[model samples]
Target: MPGTPYFSPRLILGAAAMFGMLLALGIHILGQRFGLDLGDLWGTPNGIIPATAAIAWWLIAAVAFVGGYVTASLLFSAASGHLPRRLQHALIAGGLLLLIAAGQAASGPSPVPTLHGFYNGIVALMLGAAMAFAGAHFALARH
Candidate 1:
């Protein structure tokens, strides 16, 4: 195993990020195609995308699904294939960061909504990462 390459966490993070972004952007595009513009979602005076919004939850779920997949896949591929506590924690942290970064585009286009967008993104990241790590932990526990 000395010369062998391990399952790279960086790759896992990238995969999760890509998956989350594609999902979020796809939803945005879908809304556009349906003639639902930004005005429909955040045209109000507050101009804030609420974390409780369907889009927010959708993005959160996407990150969670992707994060769990990547985490479990790497854990399953490890040489020992044993789930260590520290490894699990580290993977969860990585998943959190990946989800947050992937949601960077979630901060809507306008200045007013940008703040709320970032906040919603953070909320989504936290929930998504937790869901992902929990899923991976439970799944790996059975392995």
Candidate 2:
């Protein structure tokens, strides 16, 4: 383990922040232009926003994953070669999700997350992992 290469928290957190900002900006633009409510419109049986919102979220997720993978690759110096490529990417994506969970913990009004909120977070984070997996495939191709 002494020789094992790993990504730093600074690397993961910084990249996630940058990508998260991109997502926030995108959602902001969507909310401003279309006035779609993220909280209200998303879960209903008949959602208010078109499926395009889902597409947009997917695209943003891919971008975030790409950012994460690229950040890790840059910092870890393709020294990651010895590590299983899938494992390395999974670490990066998992780091991002944990960061998101920490963020959610800090932001929500309730001291403790409600059950529904926790459930939704799990679903959202899983979707993120899937997106990151796809992005990992794309990034590996470029590698």
Candidate 3:
């Protein structure tokens, strides 16, 4: 399978992250429907600050970690390549993801209206990127 063209790193990472995000959103909706107190990771009505922000942050972190872990694990395990090369690809993917997150934080509309919400969002984004990096690191270590 030397010549088998696997997807580029960007595609793999992006797809995994988006898929994870969607799954998290679904979970959030289900939690709401069931009257479960899952944090308001998604914005609340009237810009109200809910008590579940911490829980939401952790949820997002888990999503990001899973995304990175899956992507790296699959790519590193299936592709017949050097370990260092595979790791470099993973790093590049992580960096790209971080860039995208930063850009969104900078230019996208605020999810909440308050400064606390803004700072919390920023911290969540940073935690996401860090968790992703850690996940990829662990995945690579296993290989």
For TM-score, the strongest prediction is 3
lDDT string for model 2 (34-107, tens) is 42322333566774666655654554465557654564454345455455678768866865675565455445
| Candidate 1: tens digits of C-alpha lDDT, residues 82-102 | 556777788667646644653
Which model is ahead, 2 or 3, in terms of TM-score? 3
Question: In model 1, what is the error at residue 79, expressed in angstroms?
Answer: 2.9
Candidate 1 achieves a global lDDT of 0.50
TM-score of each: 0.42, 0.42, 0.45
Using lDDT as the measure, the top candidate is: 3
Q: How many steric overlaps does candidate 3 have? A: 0
RMSD of 2: 9.8
Clashes of 2: 0
The reply for model 3, stretches above 4 Å from the true place, is: 1-51, 81-111
Per-model root-mean-square deviation over C-alphas: 9.7, 9.8, 9.8
